[model samples]
Target: MADSLNCSSGNCSSAQEAFGLSEGHFALVKAAVLGCIFLLASFSNLFLLHALWKRRNRRTRTQLFLLHLCLADLVVAFFQVLPQFSIEITHRFKGSDLVCRAVKYLQVVGMFASTYMIVAMTIDRYHAVCKPMVSFFRGSFRRYVAISAAWLISLAFSAPQMFIFSLQEVEKKVFDCWATFIEPWGGRIYITWITLSVFVLPALILMYCQIKICAGIY
Candidate 1:
């Protein structure tokens, strides 16, 4: 029995060591991948923006949407990917309460803007293909309205992040930005709302628009 216990303990220690090593390797790989993404997204989007600016006078509705989409993607790269890369390297958020709140707010705003902007563009395409006369009559007005609504909704929806996240002391002196929620139900409710608004609803809208566009074409 003594020998068996010793053997089990040794196996457990080895397993833990292997797990720790693998986790470290994963972190390194993740940081590298995020760094590459940040660089590529920033450079490509900036170049595209410059190209668009040079042709701004002759921009079409679709081109305008693409420009806004590129801007949203840049926000994601800076606010979401860059911050995550920093966290992976440092293993903690390094900032004051205001900075933490601002970062969290902008992160969700980027996600919301990127998603809803794509949805808006898809809906615009749907209108052009499926309802040509209406699209032609009010195209510019509707385009501006849709784009403005997407941005406004993004900003409003992300407001909760500002209140939910703050800098807090995790240990005696070690601080980190963390979210606080009421016990038991708060987190579940918040996550559910986000999933529905950000993913499920947008996905459904896109799928419906795509089907209508295809039917109109065929």
Candidate 2:
């Protein structure tokens, strides 16, 4: 994500000229910043995944949910961030239509799936606290189902990105891949839904849970 932001940081060529930085210098700066981000995120997620893997036998369903969360984040870091990092280093986004679509698809799916995983975690907590007698969440099978559904749902929501983006030439024989949604209102509606699902729905759910807990305590 940081890599994407940096590469798409307001006209790269213009920025270099204004700042008097060479392509190599810009690439180096990008490498340093993106390298740090990827290193920290990848290592941390890997460590967590490893720890969880070792304790797999002892893990509860919640632990599995957390495990899925980490996996989702790792997916985003790898697909969304890593590809952009490579682009910055190469100074272009030269790839086939299939690769461009796949990269963008995974990036969007991973992002939304990560948030959905968190929402799943929150729902589990809500159930545990508010409806203690419901023993429906103990099975590992349910965790598998939930995680699968999260990815599927996210993929459904993010499918538009695949068609909305195509590789466009940015420099001589060099290309940059970005979303060029043909339907402006369609894009706006999709973005609005994404915002609601990722931000509003989760906030409302968490808030409701908090209110329930407060009421119970009172």
Candidate 3:
């Protein structure tokens, strides 16, 4: 029985070691793959931005909104993508607490901005169809306003992430960076609100507009 126990212990130890090795290997692979993807995406967005800028005088409202969205995505990809890639490559948390907070902020802001842009686009489409007499749709100012509002709303929503995220050093002395609101119950409430505000509300709005548009056409 003692011999059998010794054999089981050895096997468990070996398994753990293998798991750790696999984790490290996976992390490295993730870093490489994500790095390439982000690099390409960032450059592509930059080129698009440049092209749009060169033709700014001739830009339409829809085009302007799209350019803003592309710009936001590019910034997020440029700033946060490399950091995430580094985290995956090292697999050993060496980043500072400040950077961890920044990462969380970037992630949230990116998402908020992107979603807002989509919402703005939906609203723009609704306006174009529902209020065909509105000459503003043909003008570029409406798009500029939408782009500005999208950024403002994104910043407001992302403000919470800056306060929520933190860095903790575990028993193994490795730093784990994560975002968690300090308030337990409030955090849940906040998440619920965010879900409704960012997702459910927008989805309902889009659906309503789409249905109305379709019915109008019919």
Candidate 4:
């Protein structure tokens, strides 16, 4: 009788696992956290975007590059929030495979574009301070060229995601979202390079430019 009871309990546990996030309470909590993050990011980015957008006619080379950066950030925030919103309502992932891929792509593209644009902005500031008389720095056309280069470079950087992403099922047979090939070691390498190129290098360059500009002003 005990063997039969154990087998019956196992069946009951399996059935419970199969249901996957079928209840609303836990989903609501997740949704609340996700929504707060999205709203905060989106609202902050929207203000930046608005400032850039409102000054459309004052399109200096620097302003134009900033505008694109703001736009890219806005797009990312908008797309990033959708899945969170949907999951809140359904309490389970109801998206198609294509939707998942598209969301991932948007997230990657947004992050890539933002990183590269910040880099471009640093280089622009560098040129403005260090080579003020150069024709390339003087013209608005160069701003467009810089923005284009940022976009292209960002796309190249994120190209690996296309091959690396895959949908997987958890032990409970629930679908889980992840990038399959991006292990911790790979992430460390990527982060190291990204930190050096995007944050540290650009920040140093920007600081140099700011100091030069301030010196010149004084």
What is the overall TM-score of model 1 with all chains considered together? 0.88
The best candidate by TM-score is 1
Counting clashing residue pairs in each candidate, in order, gives 0, 0, 0, 0
Residue 206 error, candidate 4, Å: 3.8
All predictions: root-mean-square deviation over Cα?
7.9, 3.9, 8.3, 9.4
lDDT of 3 at 17: 66
TM-score per model over all chains? 0.88, 0.81, 0.78, 0.67
TM-score of 2: 0.81
Q: What does candidate 2 score in Cα RMSD to the true structure?
A: 3.9
Q: Which ten residues in a row have the lowest lDDT in candidate 3?
A: 1-10
Candidate 3 similarity to native, TM-score: 0.78
Instruction: Give the residue spans of candidate 1 off by over 4 A.
Output: 1-24
Candidate with more favorable, higher TM-score: 2 or 4:
2
Better of 1 and 2 by TM-score: 1
Error of 4 at 90 (Å): 5.3
> For candidate 4, lDDT tens digit of each residue in 1-218?
21221121112244335556434544565567778878887888788778877888876676777678877787667765656566556644556566666666666677778877876776676666667777364545566677898888777766665554445553376663445533546655655666676578667866776787677667
Which residue pairs collide, candidate 1? none
Order the numbered candidates by TM-score, best leading.
Answer: 1, 2, 3, 4
**Candidate 4's TM-score:** 0.67
Model 3 ranges off by over 4 Å: 1-21, 135-141, 181-194
Candidate 3 local lDDT, 1-218, one digit each (tens): 21221121112245446556565455665677888889898988888889888999997776778798897887578656766676666654456788777776777677778788988887788777777767354635666687789899888887876676667654376566654544556666767877887899878988988997887678
What tens-digit string does per-residue lDDT give for candidate 1 at 1-218?
21221121112245446566564565676689899999999999999999999999999998999999999999999998998788778877889999999998999999999999999999999999999999999999999999999999999999999987888776689777777775656676788889999999999999999999999999
